[model samples]
Target: MPKQMNFIVSKNSFEEFGMMVILGTTGAAMETQMNFFFTFWGIFQLKKGYKPGVAGMPFPFKKLGGAMFRKMLKGFGYDDMWEMVKDGVEEGKIKLYPCSMTMDLMRVKKKQLREICEEPVGAAAFLEMCDNADAVISL
Candidate 1:
């Protein structure tokens, strides 16, 4: 059996702070030998039409407000979180799989997701992969 690493996320947007951290951390971990699994809101980061906004933030920053915050964050030189995931994928260490159940519930189309998703897979398949994983994390 292949060694495995599993992560399950159910947060919507970037609000699920824990999942966001996992996204970035797991992306870095991609350099190692592992497969990452994304479920529910965890898949939001990969949504092609999704856009980040501060509307739901405590301060409710809108439009340019969110843009300015992003600019400030990017001054650190790293692209936004999703871009880092892309880099990991390019290195052949990352495999992005959106949960089939989540996709059906949320009505997210395959074309709506970024190029990272191998395919929308069922929970049973995800668990099959997770069973082989050396570790599993659910956020």
Candidate 2:
């Protein structure tokens, strides 16, 4: 009976998608309940020890492009969605999960994701959370 819901975002945008996730989650936290399941392209941003460009390529052939894109974000004052989600967690009304299967496929270890994620769960488990949600969105 949560007032709000869970969102599943699977696309990779030029940080635009990332923007939406941050906005949506922040909105939910302010007014309703919320959870986010990051899968596929979404998982790239959820990696624990993962730093966007300092590590490996989160996106294919877009390393330099991605870095420059993030620099642009700095000017916009775009905040890190992961850290925002963490704040939501500390406030006790949010949960963020990094898809377990996606991690395996990408060769991303659990230890690598634990730092930022509330937990690493399967899609089905995530759907279970969605079941009672007022909305379940995939972007």
Candidate 3:
């Protein structure tokens, strides 16, 4: 079985976050501990009522792209992203942490984030948590 794995999520794109979730949950199924840290643009999608959009699409095309992306994911039998995260948390194998500094700098409040995320933590605290992780992947 794998040991602790840490993920530094720095983007809020479908490709990055979606793939991370897949790998993280696969590891979790093997009883690996998964720690995900959301920072910068990554933290925004963790908020409630957030709709995911394809990264780097023209403003007018983003909505359409997101729709197409969701359809593709659904074809692959994947549930909504938030639902998957909630499942991982409820299964007790994954923990999500939002960067406190990111939130502060972006003027985002803790209450705005989903409850599945743990209490926000600074980069130092997150680094400490990663000290023993077998792998640290940045996405």
Candidate 4:
């Protein structure tokens, strides 16, 4: 059987989230089954029309720096984060799930989430899915 990988995403920063997409897609390309569970601030990434922006820099200049950093990344031939995520989904390379507990706590409606999100599940359920995974990574 192929390997299974589970990724837990709790950060909303662009760089961190982008890495998750990159790793997940790459794992899929390697014939691994990749599952991503988005929780806490990470759930925002699954919001409808959410755009990727650089974050996690010093407070005063985080937004500005992020924009410049993203522009620089584009110049280097990187696709927009959202586009990369969509591509992965289209290729049947990923399964995306939103954290049900976070959804309830944050009052995020299912309809407000992007179509790419397969379902909303609690931490217990997410852990169960990862139980047999060859590797479970948190980011």
Q: Which predicted model would earn the best lDDT?
A: 3
Steric clashes per prediction: 1, 0, 0, 0
Tell me the whole-model lDDT of each prediction, alpha carbons only: 0.64, 0.66, 0.83, 0.82
How well is each residue in 28-75 modelled by candidate 4, as lDDT tens digits? 788888889989888987888765556666777766776787788789
TM-score, each model? 0.72, 0.71, 0.90, 0.89
Model 2, which residues run further than 4 Å from truth? 12-17, 49-65, 78-81
Q: State, as a TM-score between 0 and 1, how close model 2 is to the true structure.
A: 0.71
Instruction: State the weakest 10-residue window (summed lDDT) of model 3.
Output: 12-21
Span of 10 residues, lowest total lDDT, candidate 4: 49-58
**Residue by residue across 4-109, what tens digits does model 1's lDDT show?**
5666666544444324434544655744434556676666756885655554655556445556666776796647766666666776666777888888888888
lDDT of 3 at 123: 86
lDDT of 4 at 69: 77
Top model by TM-score, which number? 3
User: Which has the better lDDT: candidate 2, or candidate 3?
Assistant: 3
Give lDDT: candidate 4, residue 96: 91
- Runs off by more than 4 Å, candidate 1: 1-3, 15-30, 53-56, 62-69
